[model samples]
Target: MADGTWRPYRVLLGSRLRSQTTYRRSFAMDLLGSLSVGALEFGEIYVIFTNVDVLGELDFAAAALLFALATICFSLADMVVGHADRLPTYLRQGTLDAFLLRPLPVLAQLITSDLSLRRLGRTAAGVAVLGVTLPHTGITWSVTTVVLLVLTIVAGTAIFAALFVCAAAIQFWLVEGAEFANAFTYGGSYAAQYPASIFALPVRVLFTFVVPAAFIAYLPTLALLDLPGPPGLPSWLGWCSPVMAVVMWAVALTGWRAGLRHYTGAGS
Candidate 1:
């Protein structure tokens, strides 16, 4: 974030943007594909909830609130960290060694390698969903709630991005376990699209304490929903989202550093 770094950062990002924009036809297809996939995921929730008034204690709008928030957060994270998905492939091809030789930060180079404009389309869809559902969800709108909403989105984005970073870093040691890391990255996003109360207590606890997925949307949505906490759950958990985000980010960065330290280098 130095004043000197801005020029290089812009150069790297703008170069990728120009190259990615060159494929107009492919870009259009990717944009539509990303948007449609999000639509289908939300549609599944709609169809399931229509037959029943509530899943646990959450109504359709409440659940949709969670979905919209999760979608927006995940979409933003994907645009920034989606390139991390290919780190393992680069390792296998020795392209990672080339990255280490670059003058820029390794993470920044990896991120700028691909910006993935298609994610912006998905983010637009999420914004539309949020605009539609928010008015009907009966939130007692206030400046504090609004601030909480924005912070929740920012924090959620950071948490998801960190998850991607951790997953990529794991490739340093286990090339074959990309799928294992993905189970948490993608699976965590998928799981967050619903009310936390809907999942069993064990799963809820794992996401909350281990992967920290619940803070991305579910817990924050609950606080904003103007609803009571499920069973014996504390009402304050909703306000704890920013804290959870900070904690998860620290953990993920630590994991990334540890992985970098253990990296055996190309052809190891």
Candidate 2:
């Protein structure tokens, strides 16, 4: 929490980057592989729209733009935020002992313990998709829209990161965590890519009320295009991505604190 905490983080970040660069060819392939996976996902969207002009009442470009926005925002989050996913492994291997001895918070150490630079490939892919689709959306260019767009993306990233924290927090109680949290972290990202309307009522409810992923890009996307929120949601909710982000973060942090307190390593 102190300003000094960042000093350690900076040192660790630099060291990790340098070490990762040692395998430049491996890194390049990892990056390219991630990008290819993203492209293939988007390619499926293209194929779907080719059969019909619209799915979920939005045209192909609009839907793709929404998908791209989620992609960009989630990719940004995963690039660094996904680093939290390693907490369980550390706990199981007793590697977390070193973190407890450090002056910095264990969460801080765990966050930077492993940085997968390869995920940046997904971010690049999202940016490429947005670049191609932005010109066709026909959304009027304005300062407010731009600001809202930025906020939407930022809030989206925070929401995704917070989800990671919650997912990782559970590891404190269950050290041998499998892909349990994937149902929300990864699943939420996949569901968020397109309009929520396409999903069943139960899914919409689950993601919206339970996971709050609808704010990541679904409602924000609608708000960006000056469209209305889906049935069962308040009309003004789409524009409240920042508020949603804050609320979700509060919940995730509370869970994290509780989990940390409950945590007693294998030695205990």
Candidate 3:
């Protein structure tokens, strides 16, 4: 809230941006790889759709928009906290001790340690797709719709980031269980890229009630698309993804702190 507090966050973000730019060649390679991979994935989806009229209520364009939104959100989260995802490995290998000695906040230090330049291309591709497809989706665009879209994207990013933080926290106990955590992180992203209701009822309930992932993509998309949601779910619920994100993040922070305490005791 204070001017003094803002400077450190700004400096940290600037340093990361500079660091990413410093490796121009590697960054370029990463960018190209990311773009190619995204294109290939989308191409497959397009090919599959030639035989089917729709996946549930989502037509091709709607599905593409969902994919684009999910990809962009995931890429942004990956860019911000990619290193945190690797914290389990670092802790197990004793490399995290070095980070503990640093004067910065543990969360900040963990986040800034690694950056994935490849995700920049993915993020770019997502934005490009959304720009091309949104106009054709039949949703009347107004200032209010535009604002909602921006908020939805922000919420998606926060939700993914919170998932990553929770995954990292789980690693403290099941150091080798990071693979399981990916079920939520990567699997959830994949699911969110589609219409959530297309999934079975049990799976839908898990994402909605347990992980709260439905709020990130499906609910918001439903609002933006002006579609009917499941019974008892309100249109206003779509707007709450960002709030859910904040709550998830707070829970993850508490878990992470507890993990750190456990780790320190074990190391001693």
Tell me the TM-score of each prediction against the true structure. Answer: 0.95, 0.94, 0.91
RMSD of 1: 1.6
* Segments of candidate 3 deviating more than 4 angstroms: 1-16, 232-235, 265-268
List the global CA lDDT of all models: 0.84, 0.83, 0.80
TM-score, prediction 2: 0.94
Number of the candidate with higher lDDT, 2 or 3: 2
Highest lDDT: which candidate? Answer: 1
Q: Candidate 2's C-alpha lDDT? A: 0.83
For model 2, where is the 10-residue window of minimal lDDT? Answer: 227-236
Native-vs-model 1 lDDT?
0.84
Worst 10 residues of 3 by lDDT: 259-268
Flag regions of model 2 displaced more than 4 Å. Answer: 1-5
Ranking by TM-score: 1, 2, 3
